[model samples]
Target: MLSILIPTYNYVCVKLVTDLQQQAERLECPYEILVADDASEDAFKRENRKINGIPNCKYIELQENVGRSRIRNILGRLARYDFFLFLDCDGGIVNADFLARYKALLDKADVICGSILHPSKQPSPDVSLRYTYEKHAEHKFTAQKRMQHPYAMFRSFNFLISRSAFQACPFDETIRNYGYEDVMMGLALGRANVSVLHIDNPLMNEDIEKNAVFLHKTEESLRTLYVHRQKLGYCTGVLRLYGILQRMHLIFSILLLYRLLRRVIRRNLLGKRPSLGLFAFYKIGYYCNLAKERK
Candidate 1:
């Protein structure tokens, strides 16, 4: 009845898979779990190889590491069941009835977004950047708010999509990076007129990297976002504001102001318990810097 698909990269997912398997067993339905290793190291390989022996679960180790978007596309293609349940390796089952809630939503919408939740408490100092940002900006996304911006809010984590809808608009494989791929997929689904339903059921996101790693990945995603902005209908929202600034010949002045504040903003973001508002400014400055570099 469902296919639980997870893409792992050097992360141990034994606990996650076990929780999902137990839930599926309780449902008493036909289900398969697929875990693909994206060419991780020996330690992860040894641990994840255990999945190979599990019943109704397949473990595939690719010789080469395909980036985030392609790996998910690969998982979708490998899924045998009609409904595909995509979960990140770092995510944990928030509740025992997680799968059941998703199953109930199957017939109601073409795509389902089981929301994301962070731990109520903060993680360690080293890995707090992702936690802080998610807690402030993303983790609290309400079902009502998501409806207003379905395309922008439709993240790729803990969601169920039928085979027909997935094959209609698979993730863009050209995006071979860490960030904004979910945004890209959401945009595609919206353009195709696919209906998305949001619910309170959430996955506990456990993967938290150091501040430095988070910033690097954020910059990488910004690069990808700038490159794809045109394809994503660039002349909307903030882009419209930017276009107006460009027309009035104020972009250079704005860029210079951003450049002046970039270092101060970066200092705040890289520090302990950083401000997400400052980080947003940092990202805007970084993306604007990239945009200026290209011209």
Candidate 2:
């Protein structure tokens, strides 16, 4: 009745697959798990191939990397069932009743986004930035808070979407980058008048990136947001700032400030306990700089 679709890259999914398989088995429902590797390296590919040995699961590796959006669209096509549960390969199943909870909501929510949590305890210094940001910002609320800004709260990492609803509003493949495709999905759903339902069925985000690596990806995502401003018409604080800069034609001045603080910003963000407020400034400044460079 449900197809669990995961798109992976350079990550082993055996543990995640095993845990999810056990949960699906307990549900005793017709469900299948599909893991699509986006041309990961040979070592990681070999390790992830073990998912095929698990019951109700299959591993398919692509010859070339199709970025994030296309790969997910491909996985959705491979699904045989009506409901598609799109999950990241790095997600850890904390709730044993995860699949059951989603199954219960099938009659009601057409597009439901489950929650994601980092480890309750502290992680290493290298990976602190992601966990800290998630805990402080993303993990703070539930359906009550999210229903207010349904489009803004929508995330692609762990969500259940019907095939019909998904085909109506698929990820924008033109955004050939790492982040905000989910935000774009949210925007599409909003246009379709699909409210993103939130639930307590949470997934543990176990695999955390190094502080430097996470910061780099954050920069990339911000740059993407700048490039696709027309598509992402929503008003984020950063986007508003960008818009204001464009109106004033003051990108060059902001670029100068960003260049002055770039090194200082890097040092702060790359440290063990980076300030998220500073990180916000860092991203805004970086996006301004990137916007200028492109011009």
Candidate 3:
């Protein structure tokens, strides 16, 4: 039996659950759906309640909000089956034969990841551009690759793993925020000599709006990336060099920073305000570090 684990936040979309229901009903093999909700204020819990009678569907509601990585870890521990298929609440199985495909690959891989595609939207060009970038980034790893380069196979949206792999190596809870948790988890699996398989099956993403909350999450993600690098003892030389290039080219830096500031403002006004001034300061520091490295 396969245990399908889904971690949800403040999402109102009922289609995610409905799609899973359809997939579960049609699957020839035995499978269970576990929905771990992170205390959403909206009617997400109530909406989920409607699906309680569905066969093999279990819903869990937390009293408080825990970050996505931690919630998934909790679900991993509670999973009753040896194999686990983790899906984001906004993601759905595009291929009806998804479970079968995973079963075929489980013996050879500790981890199996699928592709994620974007939905069409006409109004928001910025949002569309971001989604396009994300889609291309996630689709880049649809083949077998070395485990040492775990970042190449990382995507939190859709993937399958053996419970044993997680039992031996679990997600880093210190990656308490949203962004780099997937990368850190992948790296951990890689360090443990776990093999990852990337399948061609596409997971369709539901429509998601770009808002303040999403932007805040992005900033948190970058911060988490910084933390991950620190833990891994990876040098920030490349990042520092990029920052130096920005400083040496004033006009280009202004334009680049303007674009970044605009996107940051649009997506994360609620979070710490990222000012052009502070960004310039960061660039100066980055350049100084690069110069020190040269000496």
What Cα-based lDDT does every candidate model obtain?
Answer: 0.84, 0.87, 0.66
1 versus 3: better lDDT goes to: 1
For residues 136-248, write the lDDT of model 2, one tens digit per residue.
87645676788788888888889999999999999999988878898888888989987568877788887888887898798888878887987887456688887888899
Q: Give candidate 1's root-mean-square deviation (CA, Å).
A: 1.9
For candidate 1, write residues 1-295 as lDDT tens digits: 7999999998999888888888998888899999999999989989998887777888889899998889999999989899999999999887989999988778998898888888887878876678788777763498888877877888887788999999998999888877778877888898899989887888988888888889998888778877778776662334555667679988787788788887787777778878877776576667667888997
> Which residue segments of model 3 deviate by more than 4 Å?
120-123, 135-139, 144-151, 211-214, 232-295
Alpha-carbon RMSD, each predicted model: 1.9, 1.6, 6.3
How do the residues 38-138 of candidate 3 rate in per-residue lDDT, one tens digit apiece?
99875678887655666778888899888878899999988998988898888756777766777777787888887776665433543443454454455
Q: Give Cα distance to truth, residue 22, candidate 2, Å.
A: 1.1
Ranked candidates, highest TM-score first = 2, 1, 3
* Candidate with the greatest TM-score versus the true structure: 2
Residue 223 in model 3: lDDT: 53
Best by lDDT: 2
C-alpha root-mean-square deviation, candidate 2 = 1.6
